[model samples]
Target: MENLERMEGQCLCGKVTVTAGRRDAVEACHCGMCRQWGGGPYLAVHCDSDVQFVGLENITVYNSSDWAERGFCSECGTHLFYKLKGAEEYAIPAGLFQSGSDFSMTSQIFIDRKPGYYSFANITPEMTEGEVFARYTP
Candidate 1:
């Protein structure tokens, strides 16, 4: 795993906070479920298992899939993280961290499902839905 730097961020309402170790590479998920959840691709950074969340009561979790769950701030409806079940791994929204302005768009996943209405200007590496499943699924 790449060495990660400590990062911190808070929800829009300031009701919840998150601290984690993150890399500078940001990835975009263009899967249908992700688009439906955020009304667009989810731009996030993969976080280490050392993620910490404050204000537990202000957070809500949804079982988005059998192997993963999504978290958000209940008070402000701010999306927090997409976490894999039975693991400490998390994909945190890149926009949440103000310090992440230097992050670079490195790659995109589920390219096959991306809508034609929009496109990213960066010519980053991409993975198709099948490619993503094959690489990530156990």
Candidate 2:
């Protein structure tokens, strides 16, 4: 297991805040749903379930799929996390956290679903949509 570091961040309007264990590597999700939700690929860090939220009343969670949900700050419209249902896992947007300058882009998922108009310069590992399902889904 890797050592986890504590990190903190707040929503754009400061109405919501998060304190969580930080993962060093950043990942991009290029699936259509992710792009549609964010207007681009989602750059995130895996924070697992070691997260605490302040101002719960200001947060809104949307069930994006049967197995997963997306969260945002209702007051500021800041995207919060993509979480797996009934699991201790979360993909929190990297940009939301402070001191994320050291986070490295290490992987990209849903490569097959990525649009041709955009691409990343990093030569990180890539996973297709099917591969992601096979590897992550039980």
Candidate 3:
């Protein structure tokens, strides 16, 4: 069960603000698109349906590719979320939060396609390209 706690966050310029409830599990993503967009491993906190937004006027949405759309602060260029096309929800960036939560990454996605420069020895839930594609396919 998800705790009924409010999580507050804003972009670097404070131009965009997000208020969401406690999420289930935060996870790290190692896909190529994530690395290019985030400049590092993408840490994502998944919420089922308890997300709210403020200062949305400052947010910029870009279709990074055909499959995913990236959200960021237009004024500050702070990456916020990635929404998969045809998926029902968005994946919020874990780093944009204020950071006092006890959440820890419980799994990793797109592990097999991860960059060769990095590695994780600990075993956790992971997905290969085929698995991810099939799960998200409409």
lDDT of each: 0.93, 0.91, 0.79
User: Which has the higher TM-score value, candidate number 2 or candidate number 3?
Assistant: 2
Clashes of each: 0, 0, 0
- For model 2, what is the alpha-carbon lDDT of residue 71? 96
Top candidate, metric lDDT: 1
User: What TM-score would you give candidate 1 relative to the actual structure?
Assistant: 0.95
| Order of candidate numbers by TM-score, starting with the best | 2, 1, 3
Off by over 4 Å in 1: 1-4
lDDT of 2 at 36: 99
TM-score of each: 0.95, 0.95, 0.89
Greater-lDDT candidate between 1 and 2: 1
List, residue by residue over 1-138, the lDDT tens digit for candidate 3: 777877878889987888787765778888888888777778888755557768889988998888889889999998878887776576888877766367767898888878888776657798887888888777
What 10-residue stretch in candidate 3 is worst by lDDT? 96-105
- TM-score, cand. 3 vs. native: 0.89
Worst 10 residues of 2 by lDDT: 1-10
- Tell me the tens digit of each residue's lDDT in model 1 across 14-105: 99999987678899999999999999999998887888999999999999999899999999999999988998889999999999988999
Query: Model 3's lDDT to the true fold?
Result: 0.79
The list of candidate 3 runs beyond 4 A from truth reads 86-88
